[model samples]
Target: MSAPVCTIDATGIHVPSYDDVLAYFQTEFRGIYGSDVYLGNDSQDGQWVAILALAHYDSCTMAAAVYNSYSPTTGQGAGLSSNVKINGIARAIPTHSTVDLTIIGQAGTVISTGIATDGTHRWFLPSTVTIPPGGEIIVTASAEDAGAVEADPGTITTIGTPTRGWQTVTNVLAATAGAPVESDADLRRRQKVSTALPSLTVLEGIAGAVATIEGVTRYAPYENDTNVTDGDGVPPHSIAMVVEGGDAQAIAVAIASKKTPGAYTYGTTAEVVTDRYGLDHTIRFFRPTAKRVKVEISLTALTGYTSGIGTEIQTAVAQWLSELAIGEDVRYFRIAVPANLDNGADSKTYTLTDMQIAFNGDPLGYVDLTIAFNEAAFADPADITLVVT
Candidate 1:
């Protein structure tokens, strides 16, 4: 037996009906404002009005719109009837950052609808709306409010209903952010913020590289300059990953202090740089191409010891170094016996924030460093905490 005509199409498949198309569109815009509405104006004052603000109306259900009028004679005559009709009532969205809505077709047919806000933004429109049946209006499109801090801008959600005679105006307010839009104003704002050298995308790269100090640098615009540039030092430019126990200010300060000390340069190609996160670094090379290069990092002088540069800070630098050693076979910074300092006198507890490490050839340079004692180091230390790797 053959399938029914309504259920069969080209190769014998169920063909959807026009109602199905309407249903699909409706589902797409469900819950969104202006998702349901008709086209046209049912106004009195012979003027076109916006119908973008309506309740219980979806964009898929709108059709044509019209307006009606009533006239009476001076003394003895009855009344006369007439009406106006408008064809298309569609909105035009801007290309890049702006958006706009207009009333074409029957002039004076559309009325200004009231305005509303979605907590975060505001929206505007004609007095009321008159969406016709079998037509589709726009729901919400991107608008051009530009960096609203709290509010980005708004997009048109729904047009209101327009009825015959004088229709009550309602729901018309400005939007904070709009959709399906392009506004020169918005573009200009973005361009201004994006003018910095590293630009916007660099912020992301910096964030990914510096896991410990992202919030302090990325969340605040004040330090944007710090993250994008390579500070003057041995390692040239490197993203800092400064971390604090929790506070952002202390982290920022520590970063500045570390940079001030500057790095010791062994040679032009190899130099040292401490990360803003207080990770004292001996960055000898970068984007390495050599298959293997003999490298050694030392931290004997770091643990709890004061130098011509820094103060005694570490309670146990060895513990910190062991955790960072990825390979385990060949790992991090530790407290090494000094070349001259003897065990009794040298046994003095000092922070070995960095120790010596060795590796060769691979682009993935190995970092074997000692425990870093920063900020609260002086106040947070304990006496006999030994560092053993």
Candidate 2:
């Protein structure tokens, strides 16, 4: 097979042309047989030999295509199927968990409930749970919200209500924790380290097991043998995890499944779980607290800037902030990253003259503009007041 062509614009790709393959055969034949005679189309023997070479070339091309699929760096590895294969092989598949909500309503009112429908997106109800009159029952989302509905508390409007007599319906607690489907890069990184060691007793093994549980976004496991005097039930030689997102019950079960026998487990968050063997275990882990950073930007529009630009800036900033992982800092200057905002479009000309930040309704002064943290940071576009001059 011919080698891949290199170009400045295109990444190297293996696509052997029929002419190239035919030329290779011709060169080989002349060099070996010591003859200038060219293979003719009319000759049956020559035609058969050419066909055989073509078949071999085709096989090489197919092999290259297959090899590329296995690599995460290649385009073929971007598909969900490829991601599943990589995760399944590595045993690091991220589990997605349902987002639970406590539906509240008036006493003695029966509300017909289903998934929360918001325009094109539908948040499914995993199971049917009834809300007692004047009380609340927990219902879970069919899939993870990934901090979308949680950032904007009341965005989930269409609660499956067959009739309107339910009076008032709202979730008492915010749906802040749900694990999203792991991205391709994350899956690839996990696969690389998963095979490096056995997951029976080490920290990697424990982390791998917990990661496979639905709704677990991030986790850090620590073995503290020196802090025997410490409270919170952390014993000598005990293992504890600082985890972000995922259901408490599922995380506990995952910890129980992978942890060494008789090893004491401790965390900031605790849950009782029965493993597949019907063995009950109490698991403790830390859940990262979310700090909502309200951003207000005052922009002075250039000549071409339009009214729509304000809304676009708000969306861009919100999405940028939402993508941050646990333990990541929210940098003040990075919030003004111009790439997403300065799109070369007509309405892209705007100067961010002033910016203000608030934590829990208290405006932060210039000295405290940067909210540095190790926990999750949430921001909503609606909460971001963008004023264009």
Candidate 3:
């Protein structure tokens, strides 16, 4: 049977519905063969066959349309970049010189390598590192065999020159985790949310523009119209933004691109932003100062609690806290959320009798922790000290 015509959704993208395709086949079969096509019943072999074929065709058409809806110019399309972390030691090299490192994957495979300066010590892999689901690969590093005369992994191979402060480097951290190619569903959702702004001169427009910047995961923009003068950076007609994770310079440029000409900016970092018109504008934007929170929890593990339960609980709490938006408070009761520790077989429940939030090793003596407008809360698995008694 011929495929049904594609229809456009409210987002102006063409999509085909399963029901529409099924109905079209039913009608076409009845008209051509002059016999009833019973689509609703399972016993009709001919009708079922036609329905399956039409459904596949409709799905392919919808997928193609969704793929074509986004591009780099639209600000909603996903661009190329992946996050990776590289860790190793600089051995016997001069204090201020640069060193080259190679990343080796499983079975002595050379995955990728990059150069790094001495001080920062850590480098992110330039290429995307894909670790299979539920599996991890052993990654090691070796000093660049050539280039940069003084830098070498040393003769011992395993044991480097300890006298010159050279140690074996073997750890990798994903600086910014690389995203896979955007799926169709994810692209469609982004398109729907990226509605045309009224004007690229308003507060929302400024925020929308900033959101499009790569590496920016979360951001919030606020305007202060109050007459009172406080140190909070929000003055009348001034815009203050709290942004998390991105190229700071790109964010500054985006702010300059969208904000009203006369509007004032208030925040920590200020940079000269050059717009597309070749004019330079100085813009100040706030990067969220991460305030580390220490979570102390007392839990009585039930049936699902295994020896590794403590690690699991710590991971769960850290993941939940990381997902919180900037300026959002950390609720005390969320610590008790059920954690699935037993794979998928059993649901684990715990009783959190006592929980505390500590800052700088001092307990806040409260359940809810409020973060400042300019700050974001960060919690790491190491910071979560879990005691199960």
Q: Which candidate has the top score in lDDT? A: 2
Across residues 1-389, which tens digit of lDDT does each residue of candidate 2 receive?
34433222245456667677777777677677667665788877479759977886777777666656655555234443454454554323344333444456554445443666444445655344444554554444543333334423455566654544443334323455443355666666555544533545567787776666555555566676674745434568888776665665677776776777777886545566776778767777665556677788887878877767777777778767766766567777777773237554743587778887666577654434332223566667786787668
Candidate 3 Cα errors over 4 Å, as ranges: 1-193, 196-201, 275-279, 338-346, 364-366
* lDDT at 267, model 1: 17
- Clashes counted in candidate 3 amount to 5
What residue pairs are clashing in model 2?
A: 95-214, 215-246, 267-284, 267-285, 269-285
* Candidate 1 structure quality by residue, lDDT tens digits, 262-291: 432211112223565768444221110111
- 258 in model 2: Cα distance from truth in Å? 2.3
The global C-alpha lDDT for each of the candidates, from Candidate 1 onward, is 0.28, 0.59, 0.54
For residues 1-389, write the lDDT of model 3, one tens digit per residue. 55666555666456566666766667676787677645555567566756675767767675654555343223232321111001111111111212122223233323233333323233333333333232233222222332212222221123221222222333222222223344444333333323423455488777766765544555778887677645565777789887764555677877887778788898765656776788878788776655677888777867766657677778887767765778888787665562333334433455556777756467655568777787666667888887787
Q: Any residue pairs clashing in model 3, and if so which? A: 82-178, 83-176, 83-178, 85-173, 85-174
True-vs-predicted CA distance for residue 253, candidate 1, Å: 54
Ranking by lDDT: 2, 3, 1
Model 2: lDDT equals 0.59
Q: What are the RMSD figures for all models against the true structure?
A: 35.4, 9.2, 13.9
TM-score against truth, every candidate: 0.14, 0.58, 0.54
